[model samples]
Target: MGQKKKEIIKSFLLTLAAIFIMFIILFPVYYIFTVSIKPAATLATTKIELIPRNVTLDAYREVLFGFKGSKISKNFTGTIEGQAKIEDGKLYLTDGKITGAIKYGPFTGLKFEIPVSGIIFDVSTTENFQGTLKGEIEGLFVLTRMNDDGSIGFGIVREVELTSGDVNGVSVSGPMEKYVVIRNTGKAEFTAVGKFLNSVFFGYLKNSLLLATLTVLLSMIFVVPAAYAFSRMQFFSRDHILYFYLMFTQVAGGLGIAGLIALYGMIVKLGLYDKLPVLSFIYAAGSVPFNTWLLKGYIDSISPDFDEAALVDGASYLQIIRYVLLPMALPGIATVAIFAFIGGWTEFILASLLLTEKNQPLSVWIYLLMGGIGRGIDWSYFAAAALLFALPVFVMFMLAQNYIRSGLTVGGLKE
Candidate 1:
């Protein structure tokens, strides 16, 4: 009765721990999407709003289109006798006595006209009226003008210009130039974040897929034969060779392989450096010993009766392996494939050492973002990128969880 109570208590504690772990894992995912959807202005404010008070599409627009601002200056050269009218963000000449009125389009050529006594004046063909009436006024302008004939001008004015006016009232002169300012106004925070995420999400994803597939295929090729040899064939120093391979698993680390690779290069005289296929071979080589042992254990668990039965049916050793043992060891093969895939997928140290900048895996790419190009770390985009990087591995684990569990159980129990 006391043992039963202990077991029940242990199970309850395990359930509670699982729930806590799940919540901890999910918190960041919830936070990222929430921040992505947040408005720029609200993000700038101090108090955090769990639920957005004012949902806005401006953030998305800024990320896609970018923000633009312009500084426009209007220059005038004429005679003014009276005051100017300022209404609705536009300057209009009212009681001004001028010899002529000139209108200049924003970027077009200027137009000049003569006004006589508050009326339109048409002077004779070469008449130069030179009564020096001077005045000046300057201010910012927006595209808010809409004509009665259905023409639209500038939009809303974001900033007002500082103005200076002279006593001449007719002559206005200041630089009339517009300076447009473009800025990125998205929650992405930094451009590198997007690039890094892209590298890991798509770039790393492709490399990892290719590397994993090749690693698994090659590992199985070598592992199956070696396991079969160790299980059935008799050769000199076979036990010693198996012991050496088994001992290889306890080596210091990957750096030790550098010497062997160097020797191989001297003998072969081939440049395999920074190549993906070469890296895949290295990965397969490293994984082969453990995979061989794993397969050997699974094969040993299968009664030799199956192979003998196939042999009596006139099957050769290769045919027995192909037709009988291989099929029965599907679960174990899958387990080996998963191991090789994960190892290659997450293998960073060797990839970083061997691959060049362009050929580097996503893991190496992610590491590059720590402090390259003289730019500091951008956490927001980094977080987003990291989430994207982890997604595929997470998906793989979820998809293979059943097979992995069964394979592990079978291998453990049988061995």
Candidate 2:
């Protein structure tokens, strides 16, 4: 065989292998996307489906917005069965029962009954009196000035809780509020209100975004100056300090459950538990030593002649770092920022250990979904949520792909 023909065959074989490896790597992502689009009911089938069947965005919908059945009832009428008394210029109602009919659009005439205690209203001779509901449906209510016939106008200004009870044949729950109006003879009307987004999912997304953003900012703030100092300045024990940072990188890998336990105890003692900003700081701290070293190397790869030139021009050290080094080290900085973001965005163990439900990030929530392993796992919803969770990191990598490549490679060439 000719040498060129052999080379062509070798090239073909390498291309085939590359395609195969690419397929192997990307199949799981493709499968996850398919699972996200597939209907929940279809995910339970025994057959392996390479192609999704019965595609529906219901999972994504549920992940972004809560259940589709959530509704707000506009018309509710009830009677107040307790007497109102004035104390300290405030009107109070105790041991009251509000029994009424609520109409939630298509779901009409639902029985609305709630026990009320210590409901308070501010006394006002003109305009309206503002009151607060403290029962199952808690909110502020406003009563307009009495008309000439002695009837009062009323409406709810704000409600804080979702009503949990059976409304006619339907179960009412999850992120719904109520608006109420009180009329003559203790008759009150309520309008049910609903929030659109799924609080849990959005909360997790928000926490992740916040944590990632803070990690990047804090990491940059802490890492860049230290890295620049290490790269540029020489003082006593400078090498020793750099070695210690390198040593910490290795030691950190060995810190397992014991370190986490210690961290948990310390966080609880310091009253910093469940705080996302604190978590961000922790994430930034964890990335610092390695990132400082990495960035230092990238900075080192840039000739020190730039620093000398800037100095010759009467530029201060800070000015040299700002004007001379940073612009050139952007790739390294981006690389560090990306690392910090990924660390904060994807950290499950520390987040789970330190954060309560309300403060937990998406990673913690996704890990908790594994609790449904033995039980019926909602693969569709899980897939959708997981995909959404991974998107920010994926986007960061794609956006900074070139910088990351250069940052990781060029750093090693110099140091």
Candidate 3:
């Protein structure tokens, strides 16, 4: 009974530990997502918010498609006049007339007299009325239903362009902005930015994909054969060589800036600087030692009887590796593939140093978005891009969780 109680207590503690760990892991993701959805104005607040206020998709929209700003096109401008009247909570412009010159395009400074109507407003309150202007000259408008004297109405033209009308038996209309007053006039304001596909972000995405794919392909191609040979072959000094190779992984990051400088010098000397393929090769080469050791350990767990049987059955070593080992070593291979892809995708320093603007990946481009000294960072856009950048890796990890677990464990254990 005591043992069972102890086991129960242990299970509860383990569960609590897992929850704590998961919270630590996932909190940043939640924070990033919240920040991505928050409005730009709210990003600088000192208070921490697990749930962001003023949530909007503007950041995502801006990142995916650039902010196409709003401006009055110089090509289009005009004026119109009419009698405005209000009845039963609705405002109507009666006998509206476009009296003067409409400028730009085919109608450049051309005089046109046109009878129009239907600038109607659905008056809901004292402040403003929702309205549309439809006639020989058509538009949408928002206007104050009540004037000071309750006679003249004032509003800006929401749209008054490209309406077909006959001027001396000529069908004519160009894109035009106009202001109309039923006895008096004023201006209305609308603020919105247009959107266009962000080619720059997509370009970075393409380079990142290319770099990651090439890195995976190169890493797998080299690591598999090397790992298989190390697991199967009994060549002299093989253990010494493998250990020597594995030692580099521990010291690789420890080399710091000095190491990067040396690497840069080597690249320049070899004439391999600024080449993405060379960068991919470098990434693959850096990871090969650890990947080879991991995969070899995995392969060692497989029985050697299969290799002998294949040899006796007239199958070559290549065929045995292809037909037998590869099929069984998929989990380890997947682990290696994931490692290679992530290394390629997220290695910012090497990418920044080795690649030019034309080949810069998302990782480096995102860093550039931070803006240099004294310029403040746009956290909303940054968060959106970061969330998008991490999504693929997160999805891959989730999908391959079981394979990764199996591959990382049950290796280096020989009975």
Candidate 4:
């Protein structure tokens, strides 16, 4: 009865610990998402609110669309109340006109009105301005009156310039230039903290995926053959050689491999410094020994009966290996693949050393974006990207979990 009670207590403690761990892991993810969706002003405040005070989608929209707003304006030229003649589809100012009219159309009517300044001139087909007018035309056109009764100035009116326009038509004078205002439309003011987090998060995720896939492929290619040869083939000093290879890998740490890279530069002269493929090759080499040992154990567990029987049926050594051995070792191969992929996905040192700026995998990019640069880490995007990057590995593990377990257990138990 006492032992039963102890087990029950242990189970309860384990459950509580698990819950705490889950909470610790999930809290940051929840917070980043909440903060990303919150308004920019609320993010700036010292007070911490569990729930976002103001929610806005402006940040996402801005990222998708460029910040520049389209411009629309109305131009007015000619006499206000005067008769103008159209000769060859061109308006000509005449002396009989009492007033000239110029009209600008198709104003965008954006919320903010912008000040206008620049030269505007009407050019003749001969590339000459009929008249040039400078200074401010409040509405659109500059008006001039002739001393003679019922007569207005007539010629090719060259240009009209507006020195100032209106902000929502409430008159203001300044140069015509672009300006952006981030307005707080919410009930409360808020600040956005999404920039860094968004960049780092996505960046790392991409890096992890690329690293994992390439590592798995390269590691499998090298490790499986090495394991097969070590386990199944007979050769002079094979056992000693395999043992030496395994022990050497165990002793040669990652930093020691830097020397090898330097040697490769001296010998091959390939100029492979800071290359992604070189990094992948290094990762593959590092993972090979352990993965080969794992696979060799699994391959040995498989009854040689399959290969022997295939040989009896006119199968050559290569044919038996291709057909019988590989098919039987599928689960083991998958286990090695998963292990290699995970190792590469999380590897930072080789990735950092070998990759350049544009080609740096997600891991290096995330580091650069987070803490390597001047402003420091962007936690929100980093979190979001991390979760995304982890999702696929998690799914892969979940899917292959049964196969992995079966493969690991294959040689251990004799049924």
Q: Which candidate number maximizes lDDT?
A: 3
Candidate order by TM-score, highest to lowest? 2, 3, 4, 1
Candidate 2 TM-score over all chains jointly: 0.71
Q: Give the per-residue lDDT of model 3 (tens digit) for 189-231.
A: 2222212222356668889999999999999999999999999
298-409, model 1: which lDDT tens digit per residue?
7677778888789899999889878897898877788888889878878887788777776776677667756532234443344445555566778877988877776666
- Candidate 4's C-alpha runs over 4 A off are 1-211, 236-239, 254-268, 372-377
Give TM-scores for every candidate, taking all chains together and pairing residue i with residue i.
Answer: 0.55, 0.71, 0.66, 0.56
What lDDT does candidate 3 reach at residue 176? 38
Cα lDDT, all candidates:
0.56, 0.70, 0.70, 0.55
lDDT of 1 at 182: 18
Off by over 4 Å in 3: 1-10, 41-43, 67-198, 372-375
Q: Is candidate 2 or candidate 3 better by lDDT?
A: 3
**Residue-by-residue lDDT tens digits, candidate 2, 1-415:** 6999999999999999999999999998988888888776333562457976888998877777552222232444444445444445444565665655554456433344444556554433222223332223333334332233433333333343334423222222222223344544343322322222323576678888899899999999989999999988989999799889879867976888888888889999999987889988888888899899999989989999999999999999889888988899999998998998899899888888888987889999988876876438888888888999898889889989999999999998943
In model 3, pairs of residues that clash are none
